[model samples]
Target chain A: MQEKVHVSGGTALSEQDVHSGEIFMTEDSLDCAFAWDTGVAINRYLTELKNGRIIATECRHCNRIMLPPRLFCELCFKPSSGWVYINDTGVVNTFSICHVHWDASRIKEGEKPYLPAVIEIDGASAGMGIMQLLGEVEPEKIKFGMKVKAVWKPENERTGSITDIKYFKPI
Target chain B: MAILERITRNIDNRFWDPGSEAFPVKNRYTAGMAGQRFFKEIKENGKIFGSKCQSCKITYVPARIYCERCFERLEEWVDVGTEGTIYSFTVVYKTKSGKPKESPSIIVAVKIADGLLIHRLNGCSVEDIQIGMPVKAEFKPKAERRGGIEDIKYFKPL
Candidate 1:
């Protein structure tokens, strides 16, 4: 014998069919927490940030000095060659003016749009860049290949985070 | 050994480093098929409904589409009473963000027939709540009703 399935309300499956006694709906809230280890290279990189210095790891086999340092080279499949201090100045590779917040909420009236940009660090290999916020310049005036420098927060206020370098401003 | 010690020393006492932090995530959830119907009944009709498994003769509060014991599809729906007895309770003093609230909130697991309904308890003090205490759901006014368990403001002493 064939099994029969009966759904609440009627035989219709559309969302509109849920209007009255048909479809019952409810909402629930859940919270999850996690802890992550940043490991060796990044640990040292963040430490350098506290001292107001920018550093990168060099991949000996590939001859590339990468920022936001990693212990192993993705391209060469080898351990990093060594650590090197890099200049805080960089050139903007690309950028966007966002009117929406990270949570998708609309920016309130009179607030400036967030400016995020990809910056190619001066001492790293060509085409190597990291995404960071851009500030102190009008959105319309920002241009590709614009020279910028990291604006460091006061040493006492620095917490060894990317925010330690407050933002990149046009030089 | 020297290099390893240097690396470890650099990382020591850096627990409060903002750079070494993980981002928090927020998620929203929707009640499945059976829950949708159960909440709807309470919201629209001011009534509680349960799903019954004909095979096992078991009914589930806040209805489910299938029976847990018999693994049979539950097709029959029944109206359940709003009055129930408190099976368990707790006084919550902290908000989700870990901040303490000005006043404590009372949460209760109410035992109706078949299963339990967990909701906030109001109109009673923390000192007054007890196991097996009889209570009835107090729904929001009709004009204020907007479905979900919150449609019932809370359960109160009968």
Candidate 2:
């Protein structure tokens, strides 16, 4: 049976039997709020993923495709004309050894020791990358320029999420 | 278009009723590994330590995992002397709930021997914590450490 682990505070856990929801406040509480309307973009991105197609906004002017797709073409100085479907294969760019887990609920349930990485898709031009978890490689073995591929969740289980791509592993 | 109109009308209404009810909010926060270690040390040693950037030879008080200047990972730990000079300060008369309190709180930005730290100034009148004033980091009882900035308690004039 595949076991799920909860990670929080950059710490790892043995199992996923615990979770917590607690409210905390600090001097910068007001500064943490967001004024964003990411709903439309998030929904569209997920819908494409459900169809087993990796979609990114491609700029016709500059010919660069943006992931976590953008409303505007960053390089061309024009709006994204439409979407571009990409292959699952990519190259691992810069990455980090995340010794600590980030979410409190995951840590409360005892999850620790996972590596997150930024992988640049092959067709993406110049400095474009996606930040996601790196799987199937021990943290020590990860290095620059490693070849990896996206391992997607089952179609039945797919959600319109960055998390829909379960992880990337060495080819 | 009607939705846009409603949004504009709501803004106009809020301009007149400053305290008109808004969505209720719940507090939430996340601490990084470096932050966790910093607070853990405060709870144990009553002293503060900062991570020094080996590349730029700069130090970050309340230690950070990455150097803000160079964007390099900082791994060296260094102890900052308790005493430092106040860079700036403010006296806050309102509480977290935006209500007035009997005793005002004094907040200060302190430049330690290595880097800058922002915390409260306690054990003195609000007038005592001044710009360029020499002060030292002081801690409260072990039980008072709650994994927050309050861990330091405040800086006192030396």
Candidate 3:
């Protein structure tokens, strides 16, 4: 007969015991709050979005027009010189159909999977893109470099955040 | 760039109120070697046990498998009884939400044998508590305990 494993003070917990939740375990969290500081660059970029427009910064050092404008040129390692209006139109550079929420909860059955995409914005430097969602199209039809346009929320409802643009749709 | 000359120096002044967001994360903690026995005893037998380090001539609460100071293997178990003396204490007037409480609560560090256990002191007023005051552990009803610290509900004045 196998004696019941007793631990007066030895390693009594085997790998199987822990895996089966037979040992003492508890759930905890970081328990922290946070705030976001969208400095001079993204701050103004978001402000422009509230007015149903897009903007980009120009770095004279490298002659690049950067979307979601910031103060500095990342490549040239210098400050950006000026800002310019960028078009709301773009192309779907890449995308994925997500079956679950970011936290890993599944979407309700019969509901559509979210279409998160990276869109290369018009008037920005080559390869510069923004992460947005695609709507009003079938998941099976989404393709590379598909022409798309930003669908903005009404002016009165707009908040100075990325949500100002409701989504992107095929142009 | 004609726009460069007209750009104001304070580029940040024109923005709106700052936004806040959260990314909640989950975590887990497991009871290891010594804690397994310590908690199991409380959960199963409604008793508290501490490891006795004979060479160091000291005992630890929530017992350990090794002597922290002497580096000796502590195989002897000492039943540091539920009764104890108030080693230290404090009174709390603020709630977790930051509001001042109508009545303050007393917290005590009860020294059972040579081990110290920090827990709530109920069934007594704040003014009635003092260092070296005798107290005893009040175990929760048998069915309610799940082999954790909550097995002992609180320490009360004996």
Candidate 4:
């Protein structure tokens, strides 16, 4: 006979007894929430975006104009000197034709593949670029150093967001 | 000195409120080691297993590999009871997003002789469920079992 231990107020089954379908087991869900703060620099950068203007923070020491503006110069370890408005026109620094969406979902047949690119804005400083979507040009025609310009949403629809610039189109 | 003053004047003092912007995320989780074994036992064998601490002589449901009280490895496994008493419970009237639920869910901490197992309560009204009320685990049909807590649909009055 197999050994069995009885709990004070419950019946305990042996390994063999449980294997015979005398015991029971289950699964549950959990939810999480979060709030993120976009501090001074990016907040003003977005506000300027709503007004159809592009802004970058200039670091007086290093003399570099950084986009997606930072409150401080990362290299100089000092507060940014000031903001400078730059032209929307830029050059495509690099790009990719993505067959899958940001969430990794496959694009359907007959739908155009998304063209995401890093665009080096015309002013501010060399190598200062921000990632944005490429549009209004054939995927095969896009190339490094190709000039592109911002295609803004109607002014009334602008929400002071990166999406305010609908996409970057070949100039 | 003039440049420093100009920089100070350029800094915007107004802060943007949270609802003005949106960021969304999705995550996936996997069960590991002891949890996989416990769920398999429930799904494949229709059994409930608990880990027993040889040092402290205490057993835990939703089996753990180590004992919390003694900090000892719990290698001994035991089968605990299917029926248990409600140790505590709460009625969830709102969803995680703060929306009211059409029908509230009763979540309970059930006390088996071994330890407490938290799960949902069913087949009884929210007003009828009392602390210390005896309830029995109700497993989904064997074919419907997925080796998770949902394998046992919910606990009902014994």
lDDT for each residue of candidate 1 in B36-102, tens digit (9 for 90 to 100): 7777787778998888887787778878988899887888999988999999999999998999999
In terms of TM-score, how similar is model 4 to the real structure? 0.67
lDDT comparison, 2 vs 4, better candidate = 4
Ranking by DockQ: 3, 1, 4, 2
RMSD of 3: 6.1
For lDDT, the strongest prediction is 3
Maximum-DockQ candidate:
3
**Candidate 2 stretches greater than 4 Å from native:** A1-171, B1-27, B95-100
Candidate 1 per-residue C-alpha lDDT over A1-171 given as tens digits, one digit per residue, 9 for 90 to 100: 897877555444565655553454544434444544556777777789889999998887898989878888889687787889999999999999999976789999999999999999999998899999999999999999999999999999987777889899999
Chain A TM-score compared with the true chain A, each model in order: 0.86, 0.69, 0.86, 0.81
Q: What TM-scores do the predictions have?
A: 0.61, 0.43, 0.78, 0.67
Tens digits of lDDT, candidate 2, B87-107: 989899998779998889888
Candidate 4 structure quality by residue, lDDT tens digits, A54-109:
99888889989888788788787888888889899999999999999766899999
- Tens digits of per-residue lDDT, candidate 2, A85-154, equal 7777788888886555443323333444577888887666656888888898888888898989888899
Off by over 4 Å in 1: A1-39, A154-156, B1-11, B16-33, B40-48, B55-58, B65-74, B80-158
| Chain B only, TM-score of each candidate | 0.83, 0.74, 0.84, 0.81
lDDT of the structure predicted as candidate 3:
0.84
Report lDDT per candidate. 0.83, 0.71, 0.84, 0.82
| Alpha carbon lDDT at B62, candidate 1 | 79
DockQ of 1: 0.19
